[model samples]
Target: MAINILLTDTSSPLGIGLRNKFESTTFRFVAEHPAELSWRDESQVREYLAEVKPHLVLNTIGWGEGTAIKPDLLADGAECLGRCLAGSSASVLHLSSYRIFHGEGKVSHTEADVPKAASDLSKAFAQAESAILGALPSSLVLRSSWVLSTEGGSLLARLLADFEAGRSTVISEHWRGTPVMVSDVVRAVYAVTQQIIYGANNWGVMHFGSSDVCSESVFAHKIQDMVQAETGRLLQLEAIETETDNSAVLEVRRLRDCFGLQPRSWRQGLRPAVRRWLDRRGLLAEVDSAVVEND
Candidate 1:
């Protein structure tokens, strides 16, 4: 027979990418717009599982993709998942953010380390992660950082949209982070899910985001440069102080120990994000037509 996998998330770039990455059969995907749908609602999720009977569940649903993370939603969602999947044995891979740590110094975060979250969302994500991990040992927690999808629908989308609209942004000069491409994160999610189910790897929290970590200002400038080169528009970026309360370099020993996977650098992922955004923007039209289309 064929293998069945379910990709769960709200309407984020990475969430959308998951469906696209696993569009072909043998690697069937079950996806829903978690932003509109309540994955926290046990009855709803159970219904989805019943319908899909997925061998593995990749949960990309969270509030922090573009919006500031919400504490209530995080807690409630986990409470719901605990009740809903209390019995089902489907292995789960919960996608998390690099914001879980909020201090200084370059230190690698492992699956065993208790993270100090940087924001409200990260804190709640931490809570939910604890709850889910406690309930399901087979569950895998994927702690990732900044993820770029060049389209104007995700974090990259917001940044690019701001730049295209001639808005100046003040990026944190001190706050640096790893940025994973939507494609890379999705690929890792799928790979970890596969390893857990077929390869029978014991589950735990893992770090599977980009290895390259940089400041928001640097990250923004790179994007600004790319768009400027492509559209001949300069983007203004101001630097601001940023802080981290967690380890700068996190250990991926557990992840490698389990599946021997290493993610791509954020730089490698940028070109694709730009291309996708340009495609979405329909930038290929003749200048006159492009003007007309805008008009």
Candidate 2:
């Protein structure tokens, strides 16, 4: 029997990528749009859960850009969903960000470290995690940083747009993060979900991302280099020093030890991610021709 999975927030990049990932799998996927669902209302959530009867719930409610929902509302929705799922057999895999921790120096944050909510967004994320775990102790909260994809308003998409429009890309030198491709995130999600389906009791928090970390400027320059190499177009990149230096690097040892999942460098996915971004905009052919001509 195929495991029924309910995926919330189907409009986000992570949601889109996850849907694509599960298309060929044995899991039966059901998508729920964020606009259609009210997370804060317990009765509504309970009715939806009873209707869907999902064996696994992938809650990705407010992890995207341009989300109109307030932070408190998002947290409330998570708590409500958790409470609703408390007596049910369905397992939850919630998405979170590494922004919950304010990294000190080069230290990678472990799951044992307390999440330092430095900003409002981080505070909301922490609260959501607590609410879900408190409501459902078996729930898994996966924290990642710098999620990049070809679709939506991801950092990679914005950089590609800036380069295509001949706009100078401004990057901060002080901000550092571990960039992970959305596809890799999907891989981790699938692996963990499958383990859960197989009756593995490992739950709570896990951090997953690329092994290496770099500043925003370095990441932007790497993207610029790949674009220039492929399409023979180099856009001006301006690196500005910021007053605050914040690093969000996640320690992935727990994910590896628990799930036996290995981390891949974000650089490994950069070229293909860039190519996909170009292909989406109908510019891949031009890039291919440019490369061929140069050869």
Candidate 3:
């Protein structure tokens, strides 16, 4: 049976990506943005939940830029959504961030490590997770790191734009994480939802992302190299050191054990991401035409 899913914050990057990813018969999805519920309005969220009465509420809300994470807003919204879903049978699945961790030690953060949210954005993330989990016991809080996709003007798009303008892009040499592809994130979430639908009855926080870890600078260079390989355009990249401890490499053992998923390498996923970016800019056709002309 297809689960009726209510997706909140559909206007955000992740929300939009979720919409694109779930365009199939796997599950029935109804999308709503912040404009509908507004901020910290528990009554609005409660009313919407009553109207929808969905079997699963996929709360992908609080979609902000990677650079700017608003914790207070996120926490309030999570609390509101959690309270709304508390009285219903709808299982809530909330997307969280790895930025909640301090990323202090060299080892990757496991589900066990205590969260040390250094920045206000990360602190908000931590609070939000707690609020939802407390309200909805059957909720699944999946914390992900460096979610990248080809849709919209995401960080990846911004980087490409900078490259196209002949500007040297600066990538942080210190910041590190297992940058997961947003496509993989969608798949992982679906897998977990399937488990829930089938009565697996396991719900709590878990980490999800690719297996490998790399510095932001390294990842940026990989993107540059891949684009060059595809379009023959060399982009100048500048690497710099940073004192910020925003780095987090996820511990994915739970993802492997629970969902039976060993995530694919981010490099393998990058081709499609870059292809999407080029397609969005209409440069994909240009690249194809150039290839044909050269041939």
Q: Of the candidates shown, which would achieve the greatest TM-score relative to the real structure?
A: 2
Supply the TM-score for candidate 2.
Answer: 0.90
Sort by lDDT, best first: what order?
A: 2, 3, 1
The ten-residue window of minimal lDDT in model 1 covers 242-251
Superior candidate under lDDT, 2 versus 3: 2
Residue-by-residue lDDT tens digits, candidate 1, 1-34: 5666877664566667777777754676667544
Q: 1-295 in candidate 3: lDDT tens per residue?
A: 5678877776567777677766564777787544656747877777767777789878766755564345667788888887777766778888888877864544578877778776577678888888888887788888887787654444575578776677887778777788777777888887887788888777888898777888878888878887777667887888776666456688787767877878767676687678656655655546575764575
TM per model? Answer: 0.83, 0.90, 0.89
Alpha-carbon RMSD, candidate 3: 2.8
On a 0 to 100 scale, what is the lDDT of residue 225 in model 1?
Answer: 78
Stretches of candidate 1 off by over 4 Å are: 32-37, 68-71, 103-108, 117-119, 152-155, 242-249, 282-295
| Candidate 2 per-residue lDDT over residues 90-139, each given as its tens digit | 78899988777753443467889887676788788888899778877678
Output the lDDT of residue 237, model 3: 81
Relative to the true structure, how large is the alpha-carbon lDDT of every model? 0.67, 0.80, 0.74
